[model samples]
Target chain A: MREMIITNNPLVVEKYSERVLFIDGSVEQVLIKVRDMVHRKHGLISHPLPASLRVLFSPYRSVIIGRNNGDINPLQVEIVENSILKYKKHMDVREVDKENNEDYQMIDLTLLESALKDEQVNSMLSGY
Target chain B: MKLEIGRIHIKDIQFGDSTFVEDGVLTVDKAGLIASLKEDERIKDVQVDIARPGEKVRIIPVKDVIEPRVKVEGTGAGFPGVTSKTTQCGQGRTHVLYGAAVVTVGDIVGFQEGVIDMWGEGAKWTPFSKTYNVTVDIQVVEGLEVHTHEETVRLAGLRAAEFIGQAGKEVEPDEVLTYELGGMFEETAKYPNLPKVLYVEMMITQGLLHDTYIYGVNAQTILPSVMHPNEELDNAVISGNCVAACDKITTYQHQNNSVILDLYAQHGKELNFTGVIMVPEHTTLSGKLRVADYTVKLAKMLGADGVIVSEEGYGNPDSDLLMICKKLEDAKIKTVLITDECAGRDGLSQPLADTAAEAVAVVSTGNVSHVVTLPPAEKVIGNPESIAVLAGGWKGAVLEDGTMMCELNAVIGATSEIGYHNVTCRLY
Candidate 1:
């Protein structure tokens, strides 16, 4: 079985080799920042990504994320991977400051961005 | 978007010398309607009949139900991009022949079509039982593919409705209800203190016999998109599928979507009703993920604080319903989901095929597999024995005395997820 982890922080995407992670933004601020960046990357206008987004996780395509709560369905994971490959594109980026742990780590949306570009994840976001 | 629906309450329908409405009574030129519908060569024969609210009548193997409406002052006609003509809808004046519906019956296609009982114990379950139904008994060419057969009956119903809708054109309506929602941003500015909410309506788009149409286009071919709730009120979206009969939203329900209206009722007082976002319930895993994801994306784009998601059909579509709820709730957007259950006859099974911890507020429309018994109708409109082959019926569903026993699945709109009916379930 693929490994799984559930957390409120997006940095966990790179910290573990978990195949699936459920990011619960049970807190309002954590939830809003997570949503804003995901929408922005998809070409939708929203609040600017916090300055914290700049400090950690560069070379940012390291992990995939989704906006759903609880454990992800196995079938959904497979389809999301396929959709990611279909819409995959590359952009310039920098490496993460793994040692930095400030307001930066709390709202970084790189993981959610990776999830938004993921095939199944994209479908979950775009198809409906 | 804004619209004025002029309701001309229909009290009775009868065969007459011409088609027109007089003093709440609708008169149809039966021979003329049959002749017009027979224009389609695929149709072998056509018979028009009427079933009223208290009549001892049963219309079986039903395919679709449509309300007779005519766009009196709009860009498009009745059922824009559908039976009439293609044009934008949900504006101006449209006349409605309320309390009456055009019910299509006759030949069976798949095991998905249902029964409409006009009287007796069965009448209490189906919303169609309360309508003054003008049923068309159709006979398609023998050996026709199920696809062509469904199309034949579907078009027949639309044509008949368009024909009947003409009767209300020149008459004055009994009551007029107006629905107006300014631009989304404008509404937000007007009701700045209230929360903004959107509605995500998932349609069944599995295949030929399982589909929905928006302005004459199959929902399966389109991606998730936005629609003014008024467009639906103006007959823009229509039911073209023959899934299980109990929960399918007939065209009438689409024209009179209670969820949209209820939200509109509280638009300024309690909330700001942002428009609607439509998505299809696709059959494949990838399709499901794509639509579910996009649906949330649209809701987020619209800046919704709360949303109500309603699903069509059951089983697989439950995955899409829960997925939307999960994404929205995870994003901290409150959501309420409406769907029916297949909790088995004993009601012990899980209510949905998939579930998420975030899907905490769900409205159960009722169990489709729940069985019911109906005494034989004093007069049957179509085929009585068809119940045996329906989705929830067995080979011996019809008793020797002509009484029938079947699950709620065979009854049309018994558990409408749109909140059209009063039927619901509670744990015993």
Candidate 2:
């Protein structure tokens, strides 16, 4: 498996993008070799595309571990894409006022992402 | 596998290899299944088969079974319109607060569920964003008030009478009569001569009492005690004092004095006259003709200024003049007999200028102070420049050329002034 890093908030990833992996805290050592399997399907991304194809390659979190008959590939692509589209259309990100705070901060998008993830899990469990 | 509970059917269930217990109930997925039985009269006897993993299957009566089916329903929320006191920063935009996802007009959908793979005009599939058409339900109620024609007419009559009465004087008989007839004629113009006769009679009566003790007399003798008397005052004393005190003493003092004396002696103190007894010729119609006696009586009771009787046709040939005179006499009202006798006896010929002079002479000789004459075609007929002349001529006046005539003398004298000289004519 390969690892990809996203530095900005709400980062966008192109289809079939390649990146190098690191072991532990070492930046030059290769822990494993991997690439996006669905990259060859689409050409260069001139315009913004659905988020379903992009991967949120987080270095902190581990991949979901499960051995179920249903494949996560379809769910991940569709669910992520739907969430991203909804977020963009509604312009969900906004500066929120907080009590006892000096600076205005962007609303947490992580909660919304978690909610979408929960919904996906529920849908799968409900035989959808 | 087959599963049944209380005569209901539970279908397509498979038992898993493992079993788990939760909340005092054993739960197993894909452990047992049952198909619903169709309603049939012939299938009276039926059996169910139950099977469990690693257990021998058992057969049971089909009376107990349960069936299950997936039923899907979804609800969501979207923004509709704004509901805040603060002014919105954006232009041409409305903020909507929605409790649940609603299919309404101008809604921005944030969530959706169920049947996601469908696309149509109503589906939210386009990247352009979905538009929800909403409608609000409301109910309206209305009421109306209506009035009848008779009520309207009665009200109009009352209003007119009220206005006239407020002027603070009795309207002349001819004037009152003309107005009543006019009122009636407004609704129906069939009776042409009625208003004229009433107007003429009003003028004559008004003129007659100019110098005498009579004052505030109405046109149609609406009040019996005042204009119409039930009894005659025979041998009544003629007070020379009242007659001598007249403001405009005509040179014909002897004649005027004798007439005044005769009126007093014959009628007495309670003397009342009716109809148009002294009216100038060419007056068009006998003003005294009463068409609706009841209406007149009613009007009088209602305190109307006067009443009018209309004649149907051209001349006094069918004149009810005599009848009206008698009625006024019976009622003891001062009556002025009006007739449409244009001088020459022939209806087509031009009216005689002396007709008024003659009528005045006759009235004077008959001991009557009141007599009005309508002028002849060219002499008394109204010309644009002479309208004021005609109007002002009502009072017995010596014109610029020294010709004396009475114009609206009847109305002015009857209402405001005293004596025929003070009365002025108003052309209708």
lDDT values, one for every candidate: 0.71, 0.20
Off by over 4 Å in 1: A1-128, B108-110, B391-398, B424-428
Q: Model 1: which docking level applies?
A: incorrect
Q: What does the TM-score come to for chain B in model 2?
A: 0.18
iRMSD, all candidates: 22.8, 50.1
- For candidate 2, lDDT tens digit of each residue in B107-167? 0000100010012211121110121111111111112111121112112222221221121
Q: State the displacement of the C-alpha of residue B358, model 2, in Å, after optimal TM-score superposition.
A: 21
Task: Going through the candidates in order, state the TM-score of chain A alone for each one.
Answer: 0.22, 0.26
**Which one wins on lDDT?**
1
lDDT: worst 10-residue window of model 2 chain B: B104-113
The ten-residue window of minimal lDDT in model 1 chain B covers B387-396
Candidate 2's displacement at residue B170, Å, is: 28
lDDT of 1 by residue, A1-128 (tens): 22123334556555553543444533233323333334333221111111111111222222233344344454444333322221121001112323333323422343233223334444556554
Model 2 Cα lDDT, one tens digit per residue, A74-123 = 42233223323322322222111122121100111221232234334444
Q: What does candidate 1's lDDT look like per residue over B1-428, in tens digits?
A: 77999999999989997999999999998998999999999999997899999888888888789999887886878667667668888899999999989998865432334888888888989988989999998999889865677778888898899888999899999999999999988999998999999988888775555678898898877789899999998878888766557878888788888899999899899999998988887654455767878888888889999999998876557767888899899888999999887666666666665668899899888987677888877887877556544422234666789777777867888888888875955689
**Per-prediction TM-score to the true structure, in the order listed:** 0.76, 0.16
